[model samples]
Target chain A: MAPMSDSSAATTLLPPGSLPLDELIACPQCDALFHARMPGRGQRTSCARCHTVLIAPRTNAYLRVIALALTIVILMVAAMFFPFLAVNVQGFTNKASILDTALAFLDGGFMATLAVLVAAFIVLIPLLRAALVIYVLAPLAAGRRPLPGARHMFRLSEDLRPWSMAEIFVIGCAVALVKVSDLARVEFGVAFWMFAALVVVIVFQDGIMCRWTIWKALDDTRNR
Target chain B: MQVDDLESTGRHAEPVTARGAGLVACTRCTRVWPMGETRCARCGSELHSRDWRSLQRVWAWMIVGIVCYIPANIFPMLKTQVLFTHTESTIIEGAIELAQHGSYGIAFVILFASVAIPVGKFVAIGFLAWSVRRPERLHPHHRHRLYEVVEFIGRWSMIDVFVVAILAALVQLNFAASITPGPAAITFALSVIFTMLAAQSFDPRMIWDHDGRGPDNHLTSETP
Candidate 1:
């Protein structure tokens, strides 16, 4: 490479494209120069040295987004209404749903800011992002133009994607379980299973599906 | 000339002649070389070398770790217990519990660092890798941004692990309560570490491969 430049730095920030058979590029992480042989569009590739994953080109973008959207909706419903865990102690038993847990915190007199942040980031953000992705993808898949607010929705989803925090919730649960082990009994609940499934779906969709197809569709749309 | 020499021999010698010459220095050895030669006569080492590229294996591991991440989050990571009673909680339940208990700040922190950031990272890395595999030149801006995002967020995934560690250390009440890590802790930690490694291993140079020009030229020409 000639030398680092301001414009090049800016250009580097964009996402990868969906074209096939590209030359190998340097590792963004280490600045190590190398070549990669493209297998096909949307196919996953790996860095030879550090083994970082590279995604393949976009093909069939709309279908993937729709499926993910549906999955997100189902998981969100399950997470909200279902019992997340059951606790039993000294012959007394209790089960808590996601909403119930949030209410419990409110009952405990937590600050309003904390409560809102937790609800929005942990529950609302992920759901909204998933929904937005679906919304954007559905029209694109049908070969029709997105609605007037589609761009804004997509932007919102992108922004929210960073703030959604589900894994932290899992960690808290583990800590609570451990601390409470001597005092009471604990049981798995439907909400817990549903939540786990939700996380899985989110990861899969964000990591593989959305990045590949949705982006390609967006690029094509932008070009058109 | 013979008559002049004989006359000079009796008196003085002819004036001596003097000449000037150019000197060359070897970049490696600092030794002088003939004025016309290109190669270093002594060391024979090349004057330049390219930057190191990230290995493809790192990306492969990232892809594998991402795949495993799906199951890690999906499956019941830890089974909780109290007084011989057991319960299972996923990441979502933990957040809800925190929210319910008025520990919304902690809950949101954990949620963002562990859940949202990691998932976002996976998607970003996957997209970059996929783009690298394509022949089409990616938008230079997006590629750079993806690199920064991946690197910046990779460390946040440790929020869950940190929370676990903090709780395990802090929640030690003999006979009243005790906190113990579950099987999922190890898996979760591994997933985070693996994804981080994957981010570290990605070669950003792959972004420029589509331009079909040397990185040096791109860098120089693109400079503002």
Candidate 2:
């Protein structure tokens, strides 16, 4: 997913005195080991071995990240409770929200498990991720020190990244909708747009937030 | 392992890391300072980047994903009702239905996203996990590339779920026609979530861990 990084130029050179192995960060992609150095606020450094972005802290990234996370939290709630789609076919009409669709499977035993899983994938994990991001980044955004276990919280958020499937759900829905449009009277609800917007915001948040920058901020604040 | 080993002694048997090079590079930022540097001078980040237990997590998640995939295929992905008639279709059945109706492209998209990719990932991750230790003549870099490619495509398999969400939202024809997600949707989503987790858990760096100590590490061999 991290296809961005420019390492065209030569890496810095200066192999100095003995340092503990813990001080070195090896390139996960290419195993290129270079000394760690922070770039200026506007500048970024990429791994010389793989050219993966190492550190590029944008000025307002914390604030922007918090904002996007909050938005997703709100979107997930609305997506769950609100009516998702309604269709009318020759004097007959049926409508269901995301929650209702999930609950519809509850009539069966094992299906109930599926229902719970769907609800979790479509709603819970994303909500949890968004909430975690806000909790970890909000203090930094407000110029206050990160709360206790902020490092753990941020790592949790990052680890949860791939498991949060809202955007994928949205895109899958779009493709499915294309196929369904030919069969019925399709009507996208407000919740659908909410989800659609959530995808863009989440992607933007991921792009803007630098893990190194955030970790550095947390560590600095804690050490202070 | 030393660049000097190759130049000064004509011996490049060991990896650059194995040479006891007192240098560590920041994977995030290619800043090279002394080995004792605790943080990246440019990015203010902790220099440690090795994921010590990557394989264990990858295998765990892969098993979980495979387990969840069981119900995903057995249950209906969606239920379609048309003028007092109801029809439920599992993902494969739905795709076949679309193919029957000449929506071959959409059907293929669904099939590939829902079936092929998830199963492919299961195999791919297993392969990568196995091949990392067993020194294959296949270019090690190509294995690394495979891991990257899998990581990049992880979210794409969710297209089937996305399609369901979209159709569920859009295809509502009151009493006449409607499409609702079935039990399989959630299981499918879970499988995807687990697969993604498995993929993320895989350490791409392990692709470079060939025991062969082949010189091919520097020169990428043709993909076998």
Candidate 3:
């Protein structure tokens, strides 16, 4: 199962010294160069191209600590309340927030609840990651170097990023909404809207806006 | 020969460099090539150039898709009807119905995969794009880390599409209860597709653009 075809081999070229910071981690199996984190002094990370474990650079320690804290908070919130959405059809209406859904699954004695639990991975774990990033960056931003924990957290977040499933939840909702329309009467709820908003805000605040800048700021502070 | 010179000129005229020139060493034969070559002179492995424009375009589309997504979820993505009576259903509504019917597994899966994941992706991607646009050069590693996050999570955004497809295919009772696609379904699907495109279009190499010198020479020296 080759990822690329044989004849479509025309390649593009780049100039030397044009992208100094671009790191290449090779997949041991395929010998392909893919972008990856720098190996830590003693730690090993897997290659994105082949999933081969390799030694890479260390990440900041405080970031992990902060991420852990934030993760805990988000998890607590997700556990306490329903995430979003409720459905009504044929004189019967059922509702569950994110938390309610979890409990429902647990009580229902269905192992499939694991899928739902996994979905929260993005929502809850990223919160921890964000906290870890803050922890690492805040002191670094203030001109202090992070300890080893920051590096571990950085790696953990990187690994976890792909596994988070919040966006997928939204997709299922859209699909189900379409299907359920012919069968029942469905209505939107406040929690649904709030969860939607929360997803947006969380992405805005964490993914694009917050973590990188703080790290960059910390990097600059470290250089200074 | 004339065309080659012209192509080179055109390449040089462009603001970005081709990705091929960035590979310092061949993964297959360990042969190093100048950043300006299209193939590993030794093994003929195709090379890549650095082009952030695709990423930028993807970001723009993702923003638009996310905007559409919000409305798609909020404004009753679908209208449901049983026997000529109609009701509107938001994302959450559908999930609730599944839960109440003792299908807690399906219900939670719907909530997380369809509703939550898509929104999270939008936020995460949006944040990553904005951070890239910033002039700061610190934390190049972390920026790369963020790019990995966005890229890894990109596919999970499709969970919604999968759910929709699955339910639409499987859940057909006809009259006693039937499922139908809605206006928002198209929009939601587009949102997922666009965001996925955005993720694909985003060349993570752009994160290293700030360090525009070339890969670290120490990469080879440090490897065992």
lDDT of every model, 2 decimals: 0.53, 0.67, 0.48
The residue ranges of model 2 lying beyond 4 angstroms of the native Cα positions read A1-16, A19-24, A29-31, A40-43, A74-83, A101-104, B1-76, B79-88, B162-187, B210-224
Docking quality (DockQ) for each candidate: 0.04, 0.28, 0.07
- Against the true structure, candidate 3 has what lDDT? 0.48
Q: In candidate 3, what are the lDDT values of residues A1-224, reduced to their tens digit?
A: 11121112112223344333323333322233433343333334433222223332235433444444454455446543643554555555555455443332232233234324433553566455556556555666356676545544554554455444555555555655654554555566565565555455445434222232333343344345
Q: Give me the runs in candidate 3 sitting further than 4 Å from their true place.
A: A1-224, B1-32, B39-48, B74-84, B96-108, B133-142, B208-224
Local accuracy of candidate 1 as per-residue lDDT tens digits, A1-224: 11111111110111233222112233323232223333454345433322334334346646865797788788888677776766655556656666544333232232233345456656888888888888877888788877556655765676566566665566557655654454567776787777777777777676555332344345446546
Highest-lDDT candidate:
2
Better of 2 and 3 by TM-score: 2
lDDT for each residue of candidate 2 in B16-84, tens digit (9 for 90 to 100): 431135454554433344566677654444654345467788899899899889988998888888779
Tell me the deviation in Å of residue A160 in model 3: 22
Clash count of each predicted structure: 74, 37, 68
Candidate number with greatest TM-score: 2
Which candidate model has the greater TM-score, 1 or 2? 2
- In model 2, how large is the Cα lDDT of residue B130? 69
As for DockQ, the candidate ahead, 2 or 3, is: 2
lDDT of 3 at B177: 42
lDDT of 3 by residue, B1-224 (tens): 43345334433343222234344443332234456666653234445444445656876888877876876676554444456666666667867866776777767766765667776777666666665555253354455565666665556655644454333332333444433334455466567657776776665554444242222233223323
